[model samples]
Target chain A: MLLTALFVIVCVALGAGVGIYTSRDYTASNAVKPAVEGFLWPNPRIIQPFSVVDQHGNPFGLENLTGQWSFMFFGFTHCPDICPITLSLLSQVQKKLAEQDTADKVQIIFVSVDPKRDTPEQVADYVSYFSKNLIGLTGTEEQIAGLARQIGVVYIVNDETAPGDYSVDHSASVFLISPAGQWLGLFSAPHEVDDIINRFNTISEYIKKQE
Target chain B: MRYSSGFLFFILIAVQSVFAQNSIEITDVWINEAPPTVKILAGYFTINNHSDDPVDLVTAHSPSFQKIEFHLTETQDGVARMQKLETISIPAQSDFSFSPGEYHLMLFNPVKTTKAGEMISLQLTFSNGTNIDVEAEVKRSELPPHHHHH
Candidate 1:
């Protein structure tokens, strides 16, 4: 009986160790599904649902992204620092792409966390300063919040959470949604434009192979 | 040898004057560019006055534009406002600035777009009727607000 008990404890210990070793640094909130992998790379969080309006006041659903890979960031125009830097980084990517004469195969979308103040015109003006082709999206507070939830982008407004009274706290990752409207992958903060372009190219090749 | 010694003595005096002379140091400078460019950015680094007396910043001029003044931009309730301070005081043997949203060297009304890798010259006027010229490196868009900055 003593020997059997000792053996059971050993098995439990090994099982626990294995579980930890495999999923270290991973979050349960984003672990519901294994990210799809393609083009010699692993794609994270490959599919999510959302609905918002574009700068043109036109309805923009996830389905609208079906034909082109979209790069999405969550932020507002009033943001003084990080949002602009990230947007600037995207702008750099676009500039870099333009310099290479790469035909527009990608889309850059900005989703405002400060929906109350970032009117469609304001959002357009803010983003246009960085890149003319960029798209800004906003909607009712609840609508935007629900859509951000569907994906894993998190934004924390100041304690008040009231429009025009708080600052937004958001994730810094740049997400890549495939042409099929799938959440193909995400590039964590400290994004490099080259890496995004390389990954986009690699995924395009994979998608082509699949087709 | 006597002539060389005199020349060396003169050079030493010149060097001493240069070191003991009062100078203003500015760092982490930034400005906000919103509608009306009201919110300018200025941060990081302190001003050290080695002189024996206090120094006052009378005004600041940015060479990038015809108009560059000493102003503070504050954001409240989605509205950004600017305030012009009469003077910025830097006590002797002490430092000032290196603080956030306070005491900034604002640059605006650019004569033209400021490109990267170009040095910007800012003329700083002090209370002692002295003008110190300082230079700042041009950095790309500072991240939008929301992240912590000092």
Candidate 2:
């Protein structure tokens, strides 16, 4: 009787130990999923080919975004407040990346929704004020809309009281595109510099693991 | 006794001056300097109403810009839209701030390139029959400090 009781206690202890170890292993493997806020992982949407002109009047398509990570923002030069503020924050992000020697690995793109007013030359001049490394893209209304629709960006040109007087209401989120030209995700408006950098690093690491 | 009397007189004079001047106070006036090609700029400040009644800001004009208008930038569902406000009312004994991404003074067609550190003069008219002059400095936006979580 004494031998049987000792045997039963030993078996139960072994079973509990194995159960705890298996459960911990299960959770450890599941941690591979991207945990960053606002990150679209597992199934980032592949971008279709769409054409727009860059600041230098070069045709920019999905192929142009294939070489490096891209941070894209949609706004016009006429906007005095939010556009500049967002662009400045992006410039700071670019600067911080440069400090980490990862600047060349990433590219910043600004797309103008107000194509009627933001010509390629105008965009060229406007982007230069923010960062020399920044790429400004603008094109016809249809061209702009084609790309915007694919990325789920919405913009509206308010009725103008005069020829040169109006405002373009547009989505203020900053989009992150992978080097493979996939729409990874977006950082919502009122963005902070540290938050963006941290998320970018997280997403980048996750993408590396998948490869 | 003489020192106490003098202090009372000083208090009385201060009270008289407070009543003689406008009941509205302005501070922290500054403008966000934009690129040279950009036609419009944003100006920010804080308004304090010390009076017992609400005050309405009716008109604002600046010699440095061709036109000045009160505009509010409202963000809804990730879309940012700008609306013009004809008058901004400040309740009594409250503080109102005009900051980035919110209510601001839309300065259009600058008379000249306003550089950072330069002062722009503005005149504001209130519904309470008070006219106050303000000078706002042009400044570049600075990145906020990083927040660390323990």
Candidate 3:
């Protein structure tokens, strides 16, 4: 009976040790894995303060991005193909969230790289076609570049073939910012509705666990 | 034997002409309707060449727009750059699609504001002296409506 008792004790201690060791190993590996796909979890970049104007001609800076998730896309109103497709996808994302009664948690922002042509009034009219809740932003060339550079957005204004007619080559990725106003990460081109929502949910859950 | 061979040649020629007659086909022609304030729009379609000879799409024109050009949107290193394509050559017995984020017909300066469901006429010219007339319907971006899960 003593031998059996000792055997039981030894097995229990070994099982507990194995359990602890495996869990520590699992966590060590998971620490390096990204929180979610397309999310910069370990070190989300801090967004610097910059001045720009919203669709209403009101000054919008990093403060406007606080307290809500922001999905920002960089494009010009003159972009015929990719811009519209991306904006429409974002609208669907907003609509899906709204259906879940979580619409207030996020905001969609369209930043025009072609500030010379995209005036406040023009942006106002352009965004309304996609969604009434969408926020359009444009500023002077230098001001726009300041924010774009910080966010790693690259854009170039092409030479005009005719007067007032030109194209702007800009990044097609959609940048994600947390409610804390940190640059979370980006969703690359060819974004789908469900894929974004799924990743957003995964990131949100991960963040909740962190808190 | 000479007369029989001549008859066979005539039959082969007739069959080949029939194949050439129904070689080039354009399908899924549609244009994304833009806001009235926007001057540029994009059109998408698929061209299928069933003939043995390759077809080169040289240029396109539209009566509803001031200018139409073949523009290719290429995304490299996260940057989306657009270039004007002078001609798009489709190999024989192959299909080419001008879809979103790829090759598109860049329509500029619409003569009038076009709404969804409106029809626009386009004339696509080929290097082989063939012109194809297409009627493209204007469509809003196709996003699924809110799901009603009971």
Candidate 4:
């Protein structure tokens, strides 16, 4: 009887050891995801439904963001310095991604905060100057406010005497939206092309591995 | 041979100084090519003071625009805001760089169509009553010749 009890104890110890070892191995192989750089969200924020119009006068919403990554900036075409500069930097980013043959995986979107002045035709023309691949979006005040509010972007129209001589102060950071239309992270202003491309490639590789 | 090369290097440095020894030198001057309907355009440049005395930029006038103001874009707590400045002081033997997202010139009410590759002349008035004329080319791009800071 004592020998049988000893055999049972040995069996229980071996079973527990095997179970713990397998669980650890499973976690190492599957549970861990590669970490991203500064300002990456471990859990992407769910983007709510929004309706707007693209520069081509086509309906654009969260659905448009489906199946591709997007780097979105909020500014107006009238913004001379930062807006064009940011768009130019994004074009460089897109160029690098294109060299890697991953350009189709992502897009650059410029959303106008000054819808009162930035018409569809004007936006289309402005964005096309940057790159044909760049998309421009504008909409009714409410539609724009809803999307900007959800994304935590703020724009204030500065009061000036001259009618089109004013400037709209908006958030300068570029947000990275995931393929599933979730807010993944953001790259702040004073942006560099290499830094943005590197961060994007790292994130893309990690996402591909997860799939 | 090493002594001769060193002398050549000294001569090169002297030549560079001869070109840069002016009291106020403008470099990296550029302006954004505004859209047709937009009245206000932004301009950026850097001013280096090689003279022994400080220079105060008291007034700025651009023939292309009706009025010009020294403006600064300040991002505080993730919000970008611009404020007008009456004057900007440049210390002696120092440099003041006005680039995107920093000090800039806000040109209001363009007198005519300002296209890219066009030149706009600006007359700067110093506190000491010295006037400097700077010509800035209207260009559009995010990446300047120099790398971005931070």
> Per-residue alpha-carbon lDDT of model 4 for B50-74, expressed as tens digits?
7788988898898789998898887
Compose the digit string of candidate 4's lDDT tens values, residues A62-163. Answer: 999988999999999877667877898898888788888664588999999999888889899888888899999999989999999988888898886464
**What is the per-residue lDDT of model 3 for residues B34-147, given as tens digits with 9 covering 90 to 100?**
978999999999999988889999989999999999999999999999999889999989998888888999999999999999999999887777788999999997542333
Candidate number with greatest DockQ: 2
Q: Candidate 2, which segments miss by more than 4 Å at Cα?
A: A1-31, A101-104, B1-17, B20-22, B143-150
Per-model DockQ against the true two-chain complex: 0.11, 0.58, 0.58, 0.37
lDDT (10s digit) by residue, model 1, range B1-150: 657988999999998767655455555554433322213234223577877788887877775766554545443432233355678788887767633333344444466655545567777778877776766665556543333432
Residue range with the least summed lDDT across 10 consecutive positions in model 1 chain A: A31-40
TM-score for all predictions? 0.55, 0.85, 0.85, 0.80
lDDT of 3 by residue, A1-211 (tens): 9999999999999999999999999766655545566798688889999999999999999999998889999999999999988999999888887787453488999999999999999999999999999999999999999999989999999999899999999999999998888898789986889988888876765565465
User: Ten consecutive residues with minimal summed lDDT in candidate 4 chain B?
Assistant: B141-150
lDDT winner between 1 and 3, please give it. 3
Model 1 CA deviation exceeding 4 Å by range: A1-49, A98-104, A160-165, B1-24, B27-150
Which residue pairs show backbone clashes in model 3? Answer: none
The CAPRI quality class of candidate 2 comes to: medium
The candidate with the higher DockQ, 1 or 2, is 2
Query: Alpha carbon lDDT of residue A36, candidate 1?
Result: 33
User: What's the distance in Å from true for residue B112, model 1?
Assistant: 16
